[model samples]
Target: MGAGVDYIFIGDDFTGASDTLATLARAGRRVRLFLDPPDAAAIAEEGLDAVGLATEFRALPAEAIAVQMDVLAPLLKALSPRIVHYKVCSTFDSSPETGSIGAAVAVLERHLDPALVAVMGGQPSLERYCAFGNLFASGPDGQIHRIDRHPVMRNHPITPMAEADLRIHLARQGLQDLLLLAWPEIEERRATLKTHVDELMRAGKKRMLFDACDQGHLETIGAALGGCGSDGRPLLIVGASSVAEALSGDLRPPGVAAPAQGSRTEGLCLVLAGSRSQVTAAQVKAARRFKPMPIQPRHLADKTAAGAFAASCAAALAAGENVLAHLAPTEDYRCSGAELSCKLANLVAAILDRQTVCALGVAGGDTSSIIVRRLGFRSLAFEEQLDAGVAICVAASDMPQRDGMRLMLKGGQVGSDAVFDRFVSAMNTKSPTTPSGLWRHHP
Candidate 1:
């Protein structure tokens, strides 16, 4: 294989990967996301400028993350992209035990070396910002809180953020001495940004963290990144989908972008919610269109009950009713979260066996990763934007029944309450010819 692709991204989870797919495609670049790490030959056939690999690294232990990376690095090296991006959640969700960014980076470096390992600190589109190297995110109530103080992320079940200072947080995961290019320097020395990083590198810092609040900052950062490495090798990057947002401006043609809508889907859609977040709970409550199927401990623990649950969902879909399968609110179950998620995933697979939906919507970051991986999808292409942080994608698979399936994978904290309604409407209507309001820029 040759250095033919413009960018290669490895997402820590499916939600972020799908968001990046929307980013690149909306920017007018041809991009596809593979559920598994794909080969150069398979990618070349798609005629894409960008290729992505989605993984469940965000929900795995450090040892398991390292093991997955070790298996992936060799194949990634063969892709020979101009930039290798490690895409993380805009919230920077990870911990020393699970989803350790440092551990994954260490394993990757053992196989491929780059001049710099740059970390972009904020994705304003997601209301995640960093100033002076301390990360911040927004609450559903629309308040800006330091990540460690954020209402939901502060108490996230998988990786609760304890420190706002990214350096300290990542250092705890083994990435030490990261040089920060704060907003002041990024603003004051916008023209000499790359030179600033060079000086920082000369001062013994090998890794870099950049602060950005808007598109201008991302473009400036993208320029600095694009200008790196005279050796003609790809720059290795880390951050949210803004990594694509930064680079995409150059690839997009004037006035051309990803469509905001596709001709609305014309049949019943299926939605699965595995996130226990209050935000998702609100969306589920506000929904009036779907036949909600609430999961219980008995439904998963007892095979007969599980079959009844799956059959109920399939019957609803077959009867021309939209379906929303989720956990009941304010209830506790005697099982690990992972076990519950796995059973939910099995139900999705089983339902697909009996019923076919015009489109599928999935909520929750970790759940999206687990279910998409379980479904044996080969690749995903941007179908349309459901909302900020949520994208409707078309899934391609080896199975005829699954190929060309329309999918929307959403992060738990993302989108508006009417997001589900919008998916229902978007699927049954025509997509917009112009791209606008695909995302919101937090000021």
Candidate 2:
């Protein structure tokens, strides 16, 4: 490897991290996403071009984020890779008090002391775009709307976007004075991009945002990032998985084909949909092979009721029926998403203790983070791309029936309506590469 690790990314959530892992691995880059901090052996893994750390950062407050970064800064500094990417959501729907992107950058900058800090906007693959320093995202209606007016994100229960101008939105979160390198500059084939960025750095411009809406735009952004940075100090980048997409073209040589597809996993599969997003609700409605198990937030509050709920889910799977556990569409969950996630995780643990499933699927950003963390998985590797934002990952763990399990982790807004049905069918195949392990009866 050129360096111990060529690129490093810290995802704001588990779903985003898995997506980025898929993006990089599909590009033929050797990479791993660790749920916890990697030890020396992990960093020293042979032939790996990139290393990523997936966190529940998107669910944490500034103080909690700072505390976690304290443990991570030293290890990250030791890698000293060419890039340290603070990967965030494409919609950039983060709040100052919760999942504060600016607070995180401020902390990381103090520790890593990067030569430059930049934000790469727009992941066209996800239908999120940036123009004139304003963010936009596609809605369920397939209409591109400014982020603030985005149908789904506007009403997002947490960290909703209300400002389309990224500068103002970020300033509220403490990331101030961002210089925009708009799309026009990127479009004109301005060969001076790298040179201009260096000049901006010299002028005390600590942070910059690069606009992108297409693959060509990403190429320009990547070219600019590729040219900047010192020998020992890597540039710090913040954005979605598009950061990895851009880097693939700029840093890695071409002709790295994706790995062969694994075979479908056989036997029963368990899916948990803890998101209230309309996308997930639609997916749940469209599922046919999976028996719908509606979970109410109130049902999880009482220990007795939660135990009974878990038993019911186990019974369905035990009866040879694939189970799709989702939040009931009826009531509003007055609890925080984190609270709901923990409760849902408990159900997964309980079900696994009673029934062995070939694969596990979880929908929801916060729910995936909490459940995967609780599942005791050491690392997640790119297994397959089931859909646009949906990645089927392999879980490496030392726990019962978890090792070599395939995980379909998706954000609420990711995947098509038939994603759950597809997940079940994908795992029901007889292929060998498909993991034969997942949640099994512990006894």
User: What TM-score does each of the candidates earn?
Assistant: 0.92, 0.93
Candidate 2 C-alpha lDDT tens digits along 23-67:
777766677889988877765654466888999989999889888
Clashes of each: 8, 1
lDDT of each: 0.81, 0.82
Off by over 4 Å in 2: 1-3, 250-257, 260-265, 430-443
Q: What is the C-alpha RMSD of each candidate to the true structure, in Å?
A: 4.1, 5.0
lDDT of 1 by residue, 315-383 (tens): 988888999998875777667767777887888988988898878889988788888878888888876
Count backbone clashes in candidate 2: 1
Clash count for candidate 1 is: 8
